[model samples]
Target: MRAARLRRGLAMALTACSIVVTVAAAARSTVPGTPVPPRLPAMRAETLPARYAANHRFITESEHAARALGDEGRAGVLARLARGDRHFLSFSPRGDGQVVEVLGDLAHADRIAVVVPGSDTTVDTFDELGTVYASLNGGARSLHAEMRKLQPDRKTAVVAWYGYPAPRTMSRDIVTTDRALDGGRRLAGLVGDLRRVNAAAPVAVLCHSYGSVVCATALRRMDAPAESSLSDVVLFGSPGTGVRSRAELRTRVPVWAGRGATDWIEGVPHVSLDLLGAQIGFGTDPVAAPFGARLFPAGAGSHSDYLRPGGLPLRNIALIALGRGSEVSDD
Candidate 1:
């Protein structure tokens, strides 16, 4: 009886969301930034510096395209990305855009954190707010800085991986697992590549909101589990992970969940049901005991505050990345 009621509620919500999605898609039909043309080929370089140089050239070309389209704001963003200081493993100006930016030395880092952002992420809003350690790159820098402070002797790196076309916040796509599935396939490939590049480094994945769903799928699809480089998987302010429990993830590493006291996602319904021949909603609140994930303190942070500088959540995430999970504070 209770399950039936939950299904009915979810169906209603999905119906409403579908209508909104139609309107939003129509509105975006003539959007200014439709992916720039003349896509470049992927770099075949094995060295990190060569890969960075090739990606920088792509960014520069993308900036020119943005300027030609009269999008100064986007061009400006791309300009900064093409700078000599920035190191990108991948860059694409197609669709909503994608980037895999690395902070710190990737080749020699013994500790690495891969950050997967939530919905509404794109190249345009990549550095949104521009606050210290708030934007995508800033947050990566924050985590890297925190990890360095925790273990100055250990080499650390953070990858801000926006490798998929994240759905808009109000889109129906955000509510479903379609994007997450695609994102997971890509994420799984990335993890495989990372393992090949640095087989011994302890890697941690920090998934935020919808990214949790993506991370879960990646874990499910990954092969060669015994050689996995993943040391931890941390989900913060997540809606759901599309799984009932952490055991379903089949991960040997610790699965951690955390949510700030003031996070709005706490109110999202933690239920999944079949509706319209599709999976509606992600299942189980990850932080709940039923999910069987180790709970970590996130302090009083909102949905976007988990990676903010000086936040308790950021500190804990850093600790997890550094393989110092025991030092993570309960308070």
Candidate 2:
């Protein structure tokens, strides 16, 4: 009777959470955008210039569309992105849009870090060196800058990939893995491109919040050897990763997990539930002992503070990305 009562209570709580999230999401204004080209050139060292040109064209066109829609905020952002200095592997203006931006010399870098952002991220909110909490653009720039500071001689690169439509926080979608599953496939595709272009670079994926779930799903689909260039998976500020333990992930790379001392995600329930044939929660707190992820230090910060500039989390993340995980100080 106790077990049954527990399940019943969980179902009720989940239902309430979903309703609240859905209502909040409904109150937000949706951004208007144009459809991106259906096809683009494949990523290769020799074809990089062509890809840049294509992205520039897309950015220009998207800017025009945003201007037409009177969303000067997004139009201005796109205008800046179209500048000659910017480097984007891919760009799309559909829905919340997607951007794959490179922060360093990707063609020659020996170490690469892919920053996967969580919910409430969009092109309009993507900051370069500016401060915007949880912005993929800001986080990627911060991580790359930290990596360079730590190892000036190391050839490193960082990719800010907003390739998936991250759901709004506190929304019904965030409670389920549907978006994460789709995001994982997209992330896998991005990794495939990276491997093709720089097969020798050791790569680390730094996933935050909902992005952790996406990374876990992607890792499960990969069967790389223990010595593969994909070196590590780092999860921070995560609620759960859809798996109870690292062994279930089945990826050869080392899995690391951490949380800022005051991250709000710690309060989120870390249990899965079956509700009318649909799974309503991600399973397992990755930092928990049973999950088997190597722990790292995140210091004191909130949910969006993990990637803050000069923070301990950013430094350790850079260390892991550079294949120097042994040097990360968990204390």
Candidate 3:
């Protein structure tokens, strides 16, 4: 009787999740306008400081326009951008999805960490306030603080990258690579842009969950920037890196993988497919022996706990961002 009740309850919860996801996806698709940020001139490392100012001006204009259009929520986003408190690398007010954040100084930071988030993230949720370093923006802020604590003399920056559309909770898209493939190329290109702007600094991509798929997509491309420009690619709470082996990634930089002991993803079968010779599910467990990623210790918790402050995962992520892998705990 207890088992039956448990099964029934689980089914009901899944059904509710399916309904919410479908409705959200439908609402997202029905919306016609995808608000784009105002155009700015071509960028160069030396001119990025000024470009940030110019972009902020355009965002402010758009925010006011959104207010006139009676979109108070969007206007609120614009208002936040207008506050001059953040160093935004890019922002798009129109889409339910986008990237609009930065932590610490970017123009001259000697080390940088670009965080790629996973499922169900949107522009609105990107800025959603959370307690205890729970939100992506908050987590980035936490990581930046950790970096500062580790090396007060060194400059550091963390980017909360959320440009790609995430798979909804029950959408079939979540089980497929339709989004990850595109997101991967964009992520790689963005890394190249960071490379050009901060030429002397070491940069890393800290991929969590589905974001690992995006990171793998870029690294597999022949045209992607050479490994020297990227310091590391770390996968945490990863589904897979979308490769047969780390060597298959076709990059020279060391690839690292970690998972908290309690992370549910650890039990997911590592398998990817190319149906009839087309790309599909990403395969290979990043932390498994066959995956060939340098295994590192992570804090004990579920998927979202990797970036929590005072945790092993956060500390190791900071160490990797600062290129101090030797300092990471090896348990």
lDDT for each candidate structure:
0.81, 0.82, 0.75
Candidates 2 and 3 compared: the better one by lDDT is 2
| Tens digits of lDDT, candidate 2, 164-265 | 878776566777887898899888877878887888888899999999999988887754642266889999999889888899988768999999989988
Whose lDDT is higher: candidate 1's or candidate 3's? 1
- lDDT score, residue 86, model 1? 91
Question: Quick one: how many clashes does candidate 3 have?
Answer: 2
Encode model 3's per-residue lDDT on 87-155: one tens digit a residue.
667766555646647787776899989998888677666755345365678778888999999999999
- Residue by residue across 67-124, what tens digits does model 1's lDDT show? 9899898789899888889998888776467789988877778988999988878877
Give lDDT for model 2: 0.82
Backbone clashes per model, in order? 0, 0, 2
Please provide TM-scores, in order, for all candidate models, with all chains considered together. Answer: 0.90, 0.90, 0.85
Any idea what lDDT model 1 has?
0.81
Q: Please give the ranking of all candidate structures by TM-score, highest first, separated by commas.
A: 1, 2, 3
